[model samples]
Target: MRKRIVRYLLALLGIGAIGAAVFLFMFIRPLPVEVARPAEAVPVQVFGLGTVEAHILSKIGFEVGAALVELNADHGDRVSQGDVLARLHNGEQQARVARAKAGVVNGEAAVKMAQAAVGKARAVLAQKKLTNERKQALLSRQTVSVESAEESQMEVDVAAAELAVAASDVDVAKAALEDARAQYQLETVLLDHHVLKAPYNAIVVERHKELGSVLAPGEALFTLVAPETVWALAYVDEARAGDIRVGQPAEVRLRSLPRQMFEGHVTRIAIESDRVSEERRVYIACDHCPDRFHLGEQAEVFIRTAALDKALLVPETAVEGFDGTKGVVWTVEDGDLRRREVTFGNRTLDSRLEITGDLPDGAQVVTTLHPGLREGRAAKVTEEAAP
Candidate 1:
């Protein structure tokens, strides 16, 4: 009787355990899951990679070869318009100018000597005329021979020729003086050319030569960029080029200064795509660019091509697929988890997605999936943070 009673108790305990397991499986509630709802907001953004560039990039080079004597500017120096940048050796040019000036002086002296010779010739010609007259009188009275009068007349002609030669010398001396003066002017210009000045308000991007270095003609002495003409050359995909247009609003962010966002507008869009990259280039004129950005720095640009007011929006996380593919979202219907298909439009500036499918207005959709969330499963809805 004891053995039979123990067997009955063991059997009853096993049945009770099975019944408890069944009861727990049938009645126990699942963990509540957090959910989100799609809201309406405006979308505004076009993404592209950009590089910092200067609108006015210029190379500073010399027209004449010379040894660099002094360098007044260095790389990264901010200079004003007309500021002196460098100087080549001016001593030789100055010497040339001095020589030219001496030539001018000598020319002037020669001109004076030519004039004096002319005067002396004129006086001699006057004396010869007087002598010729006297000789003529003597010849007429047969007091002097005809040869003597003829010799006197020849002396006058000789003096007259000498005077003509002197006059020609004066003209030649005048021309020499003019030539000397022109040479002096040219040498002076070359001397001035030795001093390089800033052509405009710019920053020195590069210095090609140091002091005492010899530079050749047409060699770049420095590279400069206009201070206020910095721009961004953004490479945008050709597929999205149609949405971009000149004068569109844009925001630029540099990797160096991640905290700052520069406001700008689309200044230009390339008419043709790049042959190699097949990307369209866009130019952005930053309204307020920081001083730190250098040429060729990588940047991210977001162009605002179009905007819609009070558009229906959802979190980007809520978008399960893109490009009209299959998209799924969880919606709470009658307190039960329900999976629904959604169609989306362009992503907004705030990263909110635009939904286009048949979702009930003001219905809550699951932005983040929680553990144990399934169709027909009991779920609790909660608001997700706005991005």
Candidate 2:
């Protein structure tokens, strides 16, 4: 009986060993997989966060001071050169002009009167000369006493003095007329100042004063902006600014309008960066501006500093770590996984990468996440179907 029990225990041990061997064979080894090839991708260098902007902007102000009696413009109003924008109360100015005109008329009448007086003075002088001649003749002929002739000559002298005074009065009156005319012309000009007109074609962006509101000189009445003259001011990093130059092609996208892409060119670059922000100011001129754009709108600019074509590319996901630092990739060669060290260039917007190394174009790369993936290891690179 003891011998039979030993035989049964020996048979059970043999069966257990066979079952463990079968389990190891079925589950311990890795399953064979089909390796995927790297895709043929067109390399593209793209930039984002750009903006659209105006070429120029400015604030318009008034030169004269007065109450705003009328406003012909408001925000978003289009104006042309010499268009009346506003007006001031002109009652006082008009009254002063009327008074000045009346003074001119009075002066003109005074000049006429003085001219008549001068005519009378000339006649009196002629009569006195004739009388003086007669007096001299009488004295020479001894027809009258010498004292009587002397008295007649003295009367002639008095008449000549009176005529000289009248002539001087006429000259004074003429000068007064000229002064009055000048005053009238000056008043007329001031009276015209009541109306304010635009100096150029522009769009009003702001209205600082309302009707019946008093405004001081040099105060802003309405702010006008020339949409055609608008430009974009961008703040670029100081490190990347060295590659930027005037006249380089650039792309801009406004924060407010993201769907639209506006082309532009670099017009200027600041020589110095901000001391605190360490950002350089870049000015860009838009290729074409819309019919209107608001001033001071924030924008992002992309300056195409460099370009490359027909370069070998890979999926951005193949590059390891942030910004491809410590960059590593699992490339499939002969159906086996091999780690590759790659040097990356500018990244494209579509998650494609520009890579430089011995990696061949259209080479297979392992993109699926797997455990224990290393050099000379078996891996299945599942092809990510393209959209």
Candidate 3:
């Protein structure tokens, strides 16, 4: 009985060992993977993060300080140039304008009174001159006393002096009238300042000051943006920004509308790069952007730089030791894995690298870096797939 029990235990141990061997062979022997082939020349693109911005963004404010009385424009409201946007407590300004007008009227009356004084002085001087002439004539004929003639000449002199003073008064009155008119015009301009008007056709982004609020000079009342001037502002890395040029086609996707892609073209490229981040700002103008857009909305952009009819392409994951323009990739050679040094050209939006070097056509490249994969290792084309 002891020999039989030992034999049964040995048999069970052998069965367990066989099961473990089969399990390892089925599950852990060789890794099953997808293989990639050099694809036909595809379009290469540069990716960037961006935001919606307006070329004409304005912070609307009051030029002069006053108490806000009425707000004609609100957030999200559409406005046109010269549209009344807001109003301040302009009662005092109106009163001042009226007072200025009254002063102008009083100045006109003063000018008329000065003119009348000049006219009266002229008439009196003419009469005095006539008397002086008659007295001189009479004295020449010895018909009047010399004292009388001298008195007549003195009277004429006094009358002439009075007329000159009247003319000077008229000139002073005219100057005073000009000053009053100038004050009236200044007051009218100030009164207009109390009523703020929109400077351009725009959409109100924000209403900063509420009605009945006191505002200082240059205090922002509303933020406005020109809807037609909206565009995408993207930042591209300096390395990739070298090839970017104005008028390049781009695809933009807004965070708010993820599924929708907007078509655009490059409009501007900044000459100066960001010192800290090493990025350059690029502006793109959308062909048919949405009618409504939130300013500063996050966006993603892809700019197509080049398109090739036929070129060797490989998955970026299969590459190693990449140094910007060059990298090493694992290629299947005679069903064996081998590393090849390749110089890269434009990169695709889907992370595919364009190999410009003489890589054999229809060569199978590994899509991933798998462990135990090395040079001269036998590899079977398991899953031939393209992503």
Number of the top candidate by TM-score?
3
Compared with the true structure, all predictions reach lDDT values of 0.81, 0.71, 0.87
Candidate 2 lDDT over 1-387, as tens digits, reads: 999999999999999999888765544434233333333434332342323444434555555577888889998988998999989888898899999999999999998998898889889878888987987898899988899888888888888888888889889998999999999999988877778888788888889889999877677788777767677888876644666778888777777787886887888877877899777888888887555576677777777765654554556665676355336776777766677776776555466566666565555655444555656655544444341
Query: TM-score order of candidates, best first?
Result: 3, 1, 2
Ranked by lDDT, the better of candidates 1 and 2 is 1
Superposed model 3: Cα runs more than 4 Å off: 1-41, 145-147, 309-345, 350-387
The stretch of ten residues in a row with the least summed lDDT in candidate 3 is 25-34
Model 3, residue 188: displacement in angstroms?
Answer: 2.0
lDDT of 1 by residue, 157-273 (tens): 998998899889889989988998899899888888888899999889999889889989788999999978899999987755667889999999998888989999999887888
lDDT of 1: 0.81
lDDT of 3 by residue, 1-387 (tens): 999999999999999999999876655455455676556657878888989998999987888898998889898999999999999888888999999999999999999999999999999999999999999999999999999999999999999999999999999999999999999999999999998999999899999988789999899889999888899999999988878889999999999999999999999998988999999999989998986798889999998888778766777777898887899887787767778887888777787777887566655667788776767766777876664
Rank order by lDDT, top first? 3, 1, 2
The best candidate by lDDT is: 3
Model 3 residue 201 CA deviation in Å = 2.3
All candidates: TM-score? 0.60, 0.58, 0.73
Cα-lDDT of candidate 3? 0.87
2 or 3, greater by lDDT: 3
